[model samples]
Target: MKKIFTILLLSGSLLVSGCSDWLDVLPKDKQSTDMYWESSEDVEAILAQGYSRLRTCVPYIINWGELRGSSVIVPGRGTKTGLIQNFQVLPSTSTVQWGTFYQVIGMANAVLKYAPTVMDKDASYYESRMNSHLTEAYFLRGLSYLYLVRNFREVPLITEPYVDDAMPNDVAKSSETEILELIRSDVHAALATNAAKETFDGTWATKGRATKWALYALMAETCLWAEDYEECVTYADYLINATAAMRPVFMSTPGQWFNMFYPGNSNESIFEIQYDETNYAQGSGSPSKVFPYGTDVTIDSYMYSEPMTLRLIDEYTQHRGDEISRTYYGSFAGTAYANYPDNGIIWKYSGMGVADREAVRTILDANYIIYRMADVMLMKAEALIRIGGSANWTEALAIINQIRERSELNPRSEVSADNINEATEEMLLEMLLDERDMEFAAEGKRWYDLLRYGKQQNFKYKARFKAIIMENNLTAENKWLSSVLDNDNAWYLPIPAEDIFNNSLLTQNPYYE
Candidate 1:
């Protein structure tokens, strides 16, 4: 059973229970924090609430990762999403708030605080179980903070729950380096425990919970962000070399990849936000709500959003012709576009065999993906290229070839050692980046992949983004896009003005000011 993200029954408890006052006033309507952690089940319920908070953050995560990516072509020029994609958001704009993430972090902190207390109170509450709970808590907090740092760049480091004014409320933002260090500490603590135990309470915790395997994947991803390629290789190797049972397998073929989305939580999934149609009231929040489908979309007629751009659609078209793209990007009447290239949309997250827009309800239970094996394998390839020099070129090419072969295509002729050795570092990096773009299309990995490249002393994403958008008539003259390309600070989002207003000591991101 997928135990990680089972429909949470404890949200009501979260609202009514435990220190509603946040200080000394214990809950009157529900269990107090002291009473809540009395059992592992209770701890599970609280952690479920934290997961519940994460569900709310899914769309925000997409926005931060994909909107400004300039991949999607939005027809609604004045729309909020369009503005964000063009990098025109203002500090006063009520977008991309970090408040919800802090809520998740806060609940995670509560877990860390009380799980140990339960162990002290009951002899049956074994140390291993307590450590497991603590490990999950740290994973949740670390993951949340990583998202925050990625989007906002700098945010207050709140490790403890807010109890009273005696604790600082108006904390200033910390450097990305400092935030990353804290993330490292949390994941490291999680690794220190027996979380790799893989199963808990007889449920497949590997799929649902933060198994040691999942934490290792997260650590590798985190290390990549920190530009610690060696550490990335270390953790990637740990996961790659895990027992055959633990190792994430590439789906049988490129065709099976589409199945990963239709019926998610596949063997390849390292970690994903679980959704149950029978249990989850609002399945996957119907990504259609965010990406948008035409009002009258039906199975017979095409229904896609404008923001999903012709560029992305063309890329999808190319994939269809070459390898394993047909299942992913289908045409309504053998024509790819519902309305030509302008209204093209990625149908992966839309639903399964959706007969109509309303049929989306039938397949709403989508697992918000985090890491998968194919993506990780390519990541390791990039790490090898970055750390091991020319000797590693052949190995990296072999890894990339594995993904290509999975798609039923022969390896690129140019990826051989001689070609790789002769290619400039920029050329090799660009090749890797483009490969990621194709493999991870619509997975929300593209923008971050670009940003990761840009973060390395020299800026390449600016040129790449500019070149891509220049092809799109919609963004050809976009002034906001021009500003973002010219200025480094514009890359990170502005702290919502409301955030700055509420926290007097908090400063705005320098670019916004």
Candidate 2:
């Protein structure tokens, strides 16, 4: 909590540049409190900083979102993600620290609180522009809280910026319901702004910053997580029927699909954390470093050293014969099944071509995509299935088939829509889950998708969730891991011990305590 109050410094150069150069402005000095909120560019710098801080959370996102789920093999004991993979997470584990997210929230709060005053000081800072900046602030804060509530379940809801050391730091955790309500409110507020247009004039700003499409995507995702099926479907349709200029569509060919990663900000990207190797170098924190692809790359330098599980690999091979664009030499790399143990590298963020291993990316600045077209399509399909009806079932199947066709797989044998029942619903739900698994593998979404499924209707799919774990696990401690997953509270991460010690009002999750 004390860390949240630390003031973010800005450079004088930041006030004179345009949006494109905003990220280049590094912090050089703390601003005078009376003189800072006088220009629109000052607002842009803090918004850019919000994005910069969000990029720092990518490593944690990938680790927490994938390692705990059944996709990759476990890391060695001394590696950073090993504890998470082994289900040995403690409050002291480094990955569970939520400080970076708070930093993002703090930047957003500063913008929301002070950006309005800019209009009073500068004649050029119009109301429309101020509203646009405010919209982005709400979107960033809402998006940060969404990650927090998902991982921690209950967390201290900090909205106002802490400007000085004298501010109180002992805020207590809010209930999950309260946190979710706030997220919903923020999304709605953002949507009401004039700046919430779907596409910005520049492609980079459209994808890198929050747009109307991004706001709708956030609402759809939040509604799905909250179990508001009707609302989820409605918000999803807003994106599904977005204007042609901004609407994201699937890549028509396999080679083009790789564009979503390599040069990023593809037609399909709704929102992604922008990283330019020229100005914002990824250093050792790049996705290429973590999921490196060659024999020459040393394992000790990377945090995760395992290949995709055979279970996930077979999912592609068995269903779509020779998944040229999405599996094997595509989504992951290896000559053949025999070479998988040492060579099944995650190729999405590292490879320049689907089939060519030699075409590896030299620059390590692949944008971390938060949402894309396929993700929204699948989300809408899931919500429709949850709503449950003959009409809804038929629509969901059509959507699923569209995705399947894009992946080069045959359409699933159709269930009679008129005879829709619990059995057909369950079968279709499984198909949707598998499709998501194949579509978003190693993209930091597998674990959250499983959690949403398992927690639906108060653990209705709990047995199925355990079955997935049992089927994919090949470790010596499989039984122990299964036992740990039996406790519902065990699914979420514990609040960090340092945060608890720093703020006496903070409490550990009961499962950890």
Candidate 3:
């Protein structure tokens, strides 16, 4: 799903496909890009195409080998079979190497370049509609780059539409600092123009597109990763205190919070990749690759592939993944074999059918939300601790407890919003990372969690992970598969080779060599 949809945008993104109005201007440009930019219907086509770009998180995280929030403990996919299988990775065949992100950057470049032009020419109603479309472009672009820099370590920083511009010719990799600046700058641009929050008149537009809070979420993430803790606190503040109607509260239970990823029904979600089960066609976007752990779901259906591990299931059960633990979950993990008492198949595929290990996950209706109310509250808590210091345990612990209570656990006796003392920096860091783990378990936060700690203190997670893996039953060979750090290279992924070849002016990423 990540490789496929990330590239499909240049093919169908804000590029505007099925529109007759755009066809009128067709001959002047292409039949499509031309016909869609001159009229009201043209605005709709761009919007439909723009909204079509709401990319999900499954592709970015799952394929890269981060596990989801299933309470399941298995070797990461990359460690088990995807990236670490051979002593190497696929080059041309791997879209994630570079192509996927470029496509997203391209789509954003084109839409931001064109959406407003059409709005200026169209009617007032068209202008209003295009306003949201422009914002969506901004949000989507930031998302693409966020993953690009995180995974590849750095990227080609494309802000404008791709062209053979003779500017710097400097396609050299930017530092994480520079990349983060790009993200914050883009987010600021979106917030200035996309003042479209609480437009939720029970319309798909509000749900399908990014809200102002979405920008704030991006802002929080950008600052948090950069370790600008106080700034992260401020951004989270915008989301919480902005609108009176939109109260920010983290979901209290794991089922209600985590199950939101099933298909629809994610009220806490700020920006999500909306999927439609009926449109499982390969040409249309379907995320069959990332879902289905234990069920009848087959890889043959909708081009799905990937198998679950007994290891993952056992871990979940060990962690108390039972009906009593999930009072809100309809089908607890224990109910594995309603049909066959002992067979626990793929866990939860978002697609319609449960076939086999290779079935296509032919459903895009399952939305992947990038930000939610829960994330904001939790991030605020982390930032509060960073700013207020160990003495600020009460402020930070309140946020941590909200996430803990959801998992049916009690907060540490020492920390709370009211009766708290101080925390050791290590204790606060551990608490923040641990709470972040539960809050963003399956959402791709784990990889970054490792990186955040790894980059600081000279990549110390190598020793910690080595120690944990030994007790965690991660065999010596398997430990390496999880993308764990090595003393030699720090475990930062190499930049995709293709990116460097295509742009001669760009230098190869620093650490890969």
Q: What's the distance in Å from true for residue 354, model 3? A: 18
Query: Comparing candidate 2 with candidate 3, which one achieves the higher TM-score?
Result: 2
lDDT of 1 by residue, 212-265 (tens): 767888888888888888898888888777776545666756656655665677
TM for every model, in the order presented, reads 0.84, 0.92, 0.74
Q: Give the top-scoring candidate (lDDT).
A: 2
Please give the CA lDDT of all the candidate structures.
Answer: 0.64, 0.76, 0.51
TM-score of 3: 0.74
How do the residues 188-306 of candidate 3 rate in per-residue lDDT, one tens digit apiece? 87777545565543333455556776778888987877778888989988877765565334556555643455554356667655554453322123333454434443322211111
- Mark the regions of model 3 whose C-alpha exceeds 4 Å error after superposition: 1-36, 40-57, 65-81, 84-95, 125-131, 163-170, 200-204, 246-249, 253-255, 279-289, 293-332, 335-365, 413-422, 457-462, 465-484, 487-490
lDDT of 1 at 7: 22
The global Cα lDDT (0 to 1) of model 3 is 0.51
Model with the higher TM-score, candidate 1 or 2: 2
